[model samples]
Target: MAAPLSTRPVTMVSPFVAGGTNDLLCRLLAENMGKSLGTTFVVDNRAGANGNIGTAFVAKQPPDGQTLLMGNSATHGTNPTLYPNQPFDALKDFAPVCMVAAVPVVLAVSTELGINSVADLIAYAKKNPGKLAFGSSGIGGSGHLCGEIFKTATKLDMVHVPYKGDVPAIQEVMGGQLALAFVGVGPATVGIKSGKVKALAVASSRRASTLPDVHTVEEAGYKGVEVTQWYGLFARSGSPKDMLDRMSAAAKEALAKEEVREKMLTQSIEPTYLPADELNVFYRNEIKRFREVIQRLNIKVT
Candidate 1:
């Protein structure tokens, strides 16, 4: 792929500001990927709309392989159900380039609460009924959805507390005003390490290596409670076949590199690169899978 026509620089778009985990990961890979292809790789931050704004921006860009989108679950899988008029269709508006990585969402509770496990949390919710309040980053966010799923799976009654972002939600939880939250490992790792929060379980099929002592929701005897924070790459549908193939190969090779693998591991993110066609299969299946949850919960924007 690095022939005479490989002089064009690739532009990568991230939906969060600099210093965020997404931005950091993209920046880290840019160096290696850029060197591999003999071209400049730049990360553009287009933060807003909970990632929709940046995603839509990239979705509308030309399918020239130069402009690529670092698509997350929120922008690609969950936005359709969350926003009534999502400007871009995750499946229709873009071409799947590759999957970057997957992070685990950990369920944690304030130490003052005395809840040590998923069963204990359910028991406490049952005992208190609507008294227990849980905070999330925002309505329809992954944290909120995780709580909703938990309530439905356990058949418990708990109040939903939506916050502006994870910062305030985590503050309230630490202050003992909010009992629990399913927080991203990026921010929650520090607190978990400092003993500020007690981790109940990870919301994935397997336990995270970062918290080997903690069990997964599935291991807690709860059926059908798997979740992951997945991130991937995409370009507008009709991107050049050769360019897409070349980029996909480069991405997979980068993931195999020790530096990329180590950086992802530091954030508790497991790097797994998927080819373009396989990513499309995943995107379609995720849409269908989440729709059932949204419908079952009667979740809507209005």
Candidate 2:
């Protein structure tokens, strides 16, 4: 068994704001990993520019294993295409720690929309005619990507509206500020349960545990629209191999705990762990797929 990487507390940078799934998982792992590794872990929230601000901040940190980043599908997957001058290279600036969890994306609408299912939403959009608008966290965030995927799959010409984070988007949906939002299950859970907003379909292969009654994209008859927002741990590149291993080991330990797993599941976040090397491969593959999708969909920055 490897020892904890540092004598000092570790800082895990979450590249989004506080109420979203990324921040939620970041705090969860920080607390549990600290316990398992015998060191304190601090969570730093760096939000803005669709996760580029905090991601760039982490990329500049010292590679001593004391500073880790909680990266996700937005930073690693869609950012390259979304930000032409993004400061850090998602693949090159960080050493893979492990993949932490994946959350389904929900196409949720305000009850005011009178859209009860994916099919109804489509017909409503068609009837509305002049560019039905949709909301997301930001341009490159997972919600934005999921919206693009859903739009392409359904062949709907809709406008994209970017919010600061998932909570804001969901809030807008509940307030009827926007027609709907494609958001992660975690941040949308509260509104979904409150009945202020209702999910039309989950944009993943499986239904979300937090919203078990919601049908999946495939179940709603749109298989190509299935996508999940994945989160993972990463350290500044060139961190000591042993330190990286220790961090990976500690994160794995945290994820293996039953309490942590249950908390994540209840939030509609699925705990999916992958070792460092495997996670690196997964990140690269996801990045490639994202690049292809962005091009295929002509997803240009606004």
Candidate 3:
């Protein structure tokens, strides 16, 4: 039998930079899980290389269940395909804990562009061709893929401008420097509510609860453009099964809290928990799906 985990405080690594949605979600979940586990769960921001640095760090750590990773779609799903020589294998290096939540990607346009809906934007792009420009957090990010999917499905020609991060990309769109952007629901919610940007359509099968008035891409006559960024918890692969189960159960209990649900909803993240067994399958599928998307779009970091 595997040895019991140490009583030391668990360290949950957030690969993305601080103040982003990933960090916020990690902290929120860690705080609640800490309470349930009777141990302090601390978030350590190890942001770099589009989350590769932190994720790889966790992969190398001993599987005592004390070192955890707060992984997102980009870290565990898209990066493997985006980076040809990834330092670590997402599927092989980690043990699934539980899925935290999924947030929809929203296509937001500058209000000054006078584009009120996805149809309007598509029509404009078709007319202007390569003149319409869209920005993303990076070349191979979920937002970037959403833009590429939009381009493919709509048969529109638009230029892609890659930014260092989503905040700058969304800001440029709001400033009318770019035609539009595919942003995560959290930032998109704030932008929409502030009237700084107008959401054309959300790239999910169903409309987001935070933005109920916005139409989905399919509802707007554009099918097969769905992209949702999901977050999950993980531990090193060699961790004890019992320890993994305990952590997964704690995660589920934390997610089940009314306050936690409200907080996630307030941040435009839909709380949907999947246990370890189901999440492992979901994680593998996400990796495969993103790999196909990257191959189809010829997306690569280097």
Candidate 4:
């Protein structure tokens, strides 16, 4: 028989470094879920290889429901296409637990560029061609894919500069070292509010609540540019159905709390919860979507 849920502490691995959106959400959800499940949830930061290191570690762990992964778009959706030889299969190696949240991608340009809107940026890019450049968190990240989608949709010939993370990329943009950056709302909000960068559009179906003035990519007259960074929970494959169900229940309960929702919203993260079965479908569709984007852009990890 499986060990009692409370017998041992649960370890949730955040593949990215600490202090990132993924890590923050993991800790927040883990805290609340721990309360709900009457167990301790510890966060393990295993940062490397764009989240592959920690993900592979979890994939190799025993599927006893004691270990889980706090996976995001980079790990589950884009890495398969970005990496030539992945150590773990996102779908085959894990069982979906629940989806945590989604954050919109903000298309911000250097204030020195004097570009006020998406139209202005597109016009400038068309006129300058290869002279324009955009930065991303990394090569295989959602920000990079968003830049590619923007290039494809607008038919712009801009160069891509990959950084170690969004903060550094945003810093480059602020310093006029880079022309544009597709960044998450967390960092982008500070830049936008401080006037260091100008937010032209958000790559989401709707405007982010935090950036009320920024228009959606579609609203800015650009189609097919919808992209958002999503976080989810997963466990090694072959975990017990009861364990998965219990975890999912705890996640849903935690998300439904007003405090949790407010805290997530304050960070410009939409607190979203999807059950295990639905999350599986959503995860597969996201992987397919990213695969198509990579193929269309001919993106290969260096």
- Write down the TM-score for model 1: 0.92
Model 3: how far residue 76 lies from native, Å: 0.5
What lDDT would each prediction earn against the true structure?
0.80, 0.85, 0.85, 0.88
Off by over 4 Å in 2: 1-4, 18-20, 45-48, 295-302
In model 4, pairs of residues that clash are none
TM-score per candidate, chains pooled:
0.92, 0.84, 0.91, 0.92
Worst 10 residues of 3 by lDDT: 1-10
lDDT of 1 by residue, 1-302 (tens): 54732577789999877887778768877777777777788999999877888988988888787888888778877787777587778778898989988877778888888888888898888888889888877777777788788777778898888888777887777777778887777656766766778889888878887788999888898867766778888888888888878778878889999988888889778786778888899878777777778878777653
For candidate 4, lDDT tens digit of each residue in 125-160? Answer: 888879988998888788999998888888889888
Lowest summed lDDT across 10 adjacent residues in model 1 is found at: 1-10
C-alpha RMSD (angstroms) for model 1 = 2.0
Clashes of each: 0, 0, 0, 0
Cα shift from native, residue 112, model 1 (Å) = 1.4
Better of 2 and 3 by TM-score: 3
Best by TM-score: 1
lDDT of 3 by residue, 107-215 (tens): 9998987889878897788788789988887888889998888888898898889987778888887777887888888777667777879998999988898889999
Superposed on all Cα atoms, model 3 deviates from the true structure by an RMSD in Å of 2.8
Clashes of 4: 0
Error of 1 at 215 (Å): 0.7
